[model samples]
Target: MIAATADAAEPDSARQRELVRLVRQDCGSCHGMTLKGGLGLPLTAEALRDKPFDGLVATVVYGRPGTAMPPWKTMISENEAEWIVRQLMQGFPEEAR
Candidate 1:
């Protein structure tokens, strides 16, 4: 099981690159290009330092009901969501060069 996860949990480089684009563009459409906050809350590393990682995952996967933040579950997997959260907490990354 662990081995399976090790092989399948992480999105591939191409998928990861696409995910980054979606997050920066689609999510950033509301979260702000710099993730500094707009229609949604700020997603900066400092902003998320005190946040609950699990809750962040839930929000990404399940989204907040009655809010503009839509669930990205249809487009991303649990591991991918976790990766996104980790990236957000670590200042995220620059767009694919």
Candidate 2:
């Protein structure tokens, strides 16, 4: 489980760009291209409004066993996961294309 007080280490410009791409493409594959829910639940700001930060991080890190959500801890760092949780909570970034 990730710490509730985990520091948010922002990624660099290039990394940030890649992260956004991953969110829009890889994650979008299951969460829906528009993040409105498909095989996975919606990730819109309204959908994740009540979700706890730590819980979101854990879900990303450990994933939901028995569900389609696979663990992303290997793909992203604790800080990156935290960053993503915050982004989802605040409304995930839009896809430029």
Candidate 3:
């Protein structure tokens, strides 16, 4: 299990860029190019406002079973997953050009 805390450090700038691309390209395929919703649920800040933060992080790391959301544990660390959830809840960043 992830040894997560509210004080988890954010990913470095370079890795942050990579995570953005992963979300936009891989995750966007289902969450929508704009994360507004598609085969997957909308990841917009508004849609996630009332949702639990840690739960979202867990979904990213472990994924929702019996669904198309596959676990990303092999690709990302728990801290990285936490960072992504924070960014998504605040309006995910666009990939750097």
- The lDDT of each candidate is 0.87, 0.84, 0.91
47-95, model 2: which lDDT tens digit per residue?
9988888999889888999999999877888788878888888888885
State candidate 3's TM-score: 0.90
Clashing pairs in 1: none
For model 1 the local lDDT of residue 52 reads 97
Candidate that scores best on lDDT? 3
Task: Please give the distance, in angstroms, between residue 33's alpha carbon in candidate 2 and its true position after superposition.
Answer: 1.5
Clashing pairs in 2: none
Candidate 1 ranges with C-alpha deviation above 4 Å:
1-8
Most TM-score-accurate candidate: 3
Better by TM-score, candidate 3 or 2: 3
Cα RMSD (angstroms) for every candidate in the order listed? 3.6, 3.2, 2.5
Candidate 3 lDDT (Cα, whole model)?
0.91
| Candidate 2 RMSD to the real structure | 3.2
lDDT for each residue of candidate 1 in 1-97, tens digit (9 for 90 to 100): 0112354467789988998898899899999988999999999999999999999998998889999988888778778888899999999998977
